[model samples]
Target: MVRPDKVEAVAEIAENFRGASASVVTEYRGLTMAQLTTLRRSLGDGATYRVAKNTLVKRAAEDAGVEGLDSMLVGPTAITFITGEPVDAAKALREFARTNQGLVIKGGFMEGRALSVDEVNRLADLESREVLLSKMAGAMKGTMAKAAGLFAAPASQVARLAQALADKRAEEGGAAPAAEAAPESDTDSAS
Candidate 1:
């Protein structure tokens, strides 16, 4: 028979797992209180890092329909539930672990796919979604501007050529060619 408190905890954990967009499992074997606080602060509102019983986590993972976490739920585990952009959370976790050696990134899951420890590191290596999007937008804008310039190039050249011809014709004489040219018998096609 399971205790009511344990059952409720499992339910809550399962709910969190279900609601989270992604989650990273970590081993907080020797992290101090201050370090944990700092890690949580660094993770900010994008993720929640909490310590849970391995058994409870297993149950919750199963209940939440999440996979690839059973092996990682060993030896004092803490999980980061990422609700916002996974890249941001991964970056924060990676940075925190880099500084605080006590934290170890075991593995993670995203969109029903299992990620190994190295994969998590690779995910952390990626830039934030907003930054990537902005860079792509800038690139697209530049490409559009270049296209617009290309589109107008021929028209602009034609206008310049016409203006130059007009200026040359004006410099030669203000009178029209028909007015200046008299009816001639020599070198005249319409004679």
Candidate 2:
């Protein structure tokens, strides 16, 4: 029989699962208290770094409608529940792992889909939301600028052609004979 406190813990984990945008399970076997603290601080407030029981976490994951997470809850597992930005959480964990050899990333889940370690690492390499949005905005601005240029190209060509024609006429001293007054009206009534 499970204790009431255990049930509450599971409930709390389940709630976190519901709110998390992504979660990564890692094996923190040889990490010191200070190292763990540093890692948690690096993850920032957007991510929750918790060392919960595997069985309770499995139960919470099941309750939260996320499947296939059981296989990743192996030895010395600690889960990072990402709230604000999944990419940020991934980046934090990746950076920590780079310096610390003991922290091994097992796997993760993003938007209810199971993700492999390689997939999580790829996510970590991604730029921030603002950078991506700015890139998109810059691309859109470039496209609009090109479209504006395309729209004005014909009018610019016409204006250039008119100027060239006027310049040639000015250089020639007058309009062409064909464009001059139709041979002055011949009135021979006096003759």
Candidate 3:
């Protein structure tokens, strides 16, 4: 016998699970309401931090087809559902946990994989996507510049060689060879 409110809650939680790109579960056992509010503010607009009953969260996770979180659904639990960059959210959580001992990062799930606590820390250590993309773009641009230089090298070398040969021939008074090597006209011989 499920109450309508409980059913609605489950549906809402399940929707949050489905809509989130990544979710991290944490135990907020010793945190005060003020600390919780501060923590939520620190998470930024890209993430939503919500506290829910273990049973409801478990049910929601099951409904959303998200597994590997059953073991983390213990004690006073809150979940951070990240809609934006997972790395940013993970970093915020890790930082907040460092200062606020009450917040314990249990684990997280992202990119169709369950993340362990250490994995979540590693995720936090990663640079933002935009940074990584810009670095790769810079690398590619350098490669392209090198390729262009490589392509132009042979042509420039050939031009320099031709110019050098011309200068050497001019220096040796060799221009007369060009006039002397001209072909004789067949018409003059026929006449």
Pick the lDDT winner.
3
Identify the runs in model 3 with alpha carbons over 4 angstroms from their true place: 174-191
Q: Provide the overall lDDT of each model, using Cα atoms, as 2-decimal numbers.
A: 0.91, 0.91, 0.92
lDDT of candidate 3? 0.92
RMSD (CA, Å), candidate 1 to true, equals 4.1
Query: Could you tell me how far off, in angstroms, the CA of residue 52 lies in candidate 2 after the best superposition?
Result: 0.5
lDDT of 3 at 187: 48
Instruction: Give the clashing residue pairs of candidate 2, or none.
Output: none
**Which stretch of 10 consecutive residues in model 2 shows the poorest summed lDDT?**
182-191
Higher-lDDT candidate of 1 and 2: 1
In the range 110-137, model 3's lDDT, one tens digit per residue, is: 8777789999999999999999999999
Off by over 4 Å in 1: 167-191
Q: What is the TM-score of each candidate against the true structure?
A: 0.86, 0.87, 0.88
- Clash counts for all predictions: 0, 0, 0
**Top candidate when judged by TM-score against the true structure:** 3
Q: After superposition, how far is residue 10 of candidate 1 from its true place, in Å?
A: 1.1
Each model's Cα RMSD = 4.1, 3.8, 5.9
Q: lDDT rank, highest first?
A: 3, 1, 2
Give candidate 1's error at residue 156 in angstroms: 0.5
Residues 159-189, candidate 1: write the lDDT tens digits: 9999999898897776666565654434487
Off by over 4 Å in 2: 169-191
